[model samples]
Target: MMRVLLAVLFVSAGVMHFVIEPTFTAMVPPFLPAPRVLVWISGVAEIALGLATLAPRLRPYAGWGLVALLIAVFPANVYMVFDDTPAIDAPRWALWARLPIQALLVGWAIWATEATKLVRR
Candidate 1:
């Protein structure tokens, strides 16, 4: 089901955060302090949210937390697009496309967790 997929996605991403720490660290905008700290914290949050989403009673909170997490990490996505860092090596279109993809992910989390509906603007 959607819930299971979300859990896997988050868990895998969380693990990758550690496995490929430098790649993620490069995405952090220069304005942000302590890239290593942010990367580790984000990874931990992803793992926690992924596990929490599995619990029916905690699904709502986990979903909202994911939404916040996605929003919080968005600047890194932006930084990637502009910097076009060779570290990730993603195609230009794919890099730009990640913006809307984040919204879609937020919607997916809401649907999977049965949280409040996301109204399209």
Candidate 2:
């Protein structure tokens, strides 16, 4: 099911934060004075998102949380394209592609959570 897939994706992406810490650190926004701290925070958020998405009672909150988180962290995505972070290992367009795809992820998370009828009362 799509919900299962989204949950798995979130889990995998959350786990990847630790696995790809250095690369994520490189994508941190220039305006942020402490890139390393932000990276860690994002990692923690991602892990929380992943876990939240898996909990039926928490899925709707997780879905909306992910949407907000994606919007909040979008600056990093922009910086990666703008600053040309070599650590990402992607083409210029690929970097640009990440932005809208993130929005799509927000939609996906919402639909997945709703389709499962997991929203708490």
Candidate 3:
């Protein structure tokens, strides 16, 4: 199901933070203090929210959390595209693509967990 897929996506991404620590840490914007710490915290949050999405009662909250997380990390995506010396070795177009993908992920989290219904009430 789409919900399961979303959960897997997030959970896998979270695990990758630790598996590829340097890569994720590199994505942190230069302005942020303690980039490694921030990466760790966000990884844990992603894992928790991903698992929470599996519980019907928790799905809505997880959805909103994902939206917030996506927004919060957006600056890094922007930085990747614009920074003169990007930490990651990705191509410029690939980095640029991540921006819109973030939006799609937000929309997916909302739709998969039915977060909009909560907003309607």
lDDT of 1 by residue, 1-121 (tens): 8899999999899989999999999999999999999999999999999989999888888999999999999999999889967788889899899999999999999889877733331
Q: Ranking by TM-score, best first? A: 3, 1, 2
Choose the strongest candidate by TM-score.
3
Q: Write one digit per residue (lDDT tens) for candidate 3, span 3-94.
A: 99999999999999899999888888889999999999999999999999999999998999999999999998898888755448888898
Per-model TM-score versus the true fold: 0.93, 0.86, 0.94
Those runs of model 2 whose alpha carbons end farther than 4 Å from true positions after fitting are 115-121
Q: List the residue pairs that clash in candidate 2.
A: none
Give lDDT: candidate 1, residue 45: 95
lDDT-superior candidate, 1 or 2 = 1
Q: Which lDDT values do the candidates have, in the order given? A: 0.91, 0.79, 0.92
lDDT of 1: 0.91
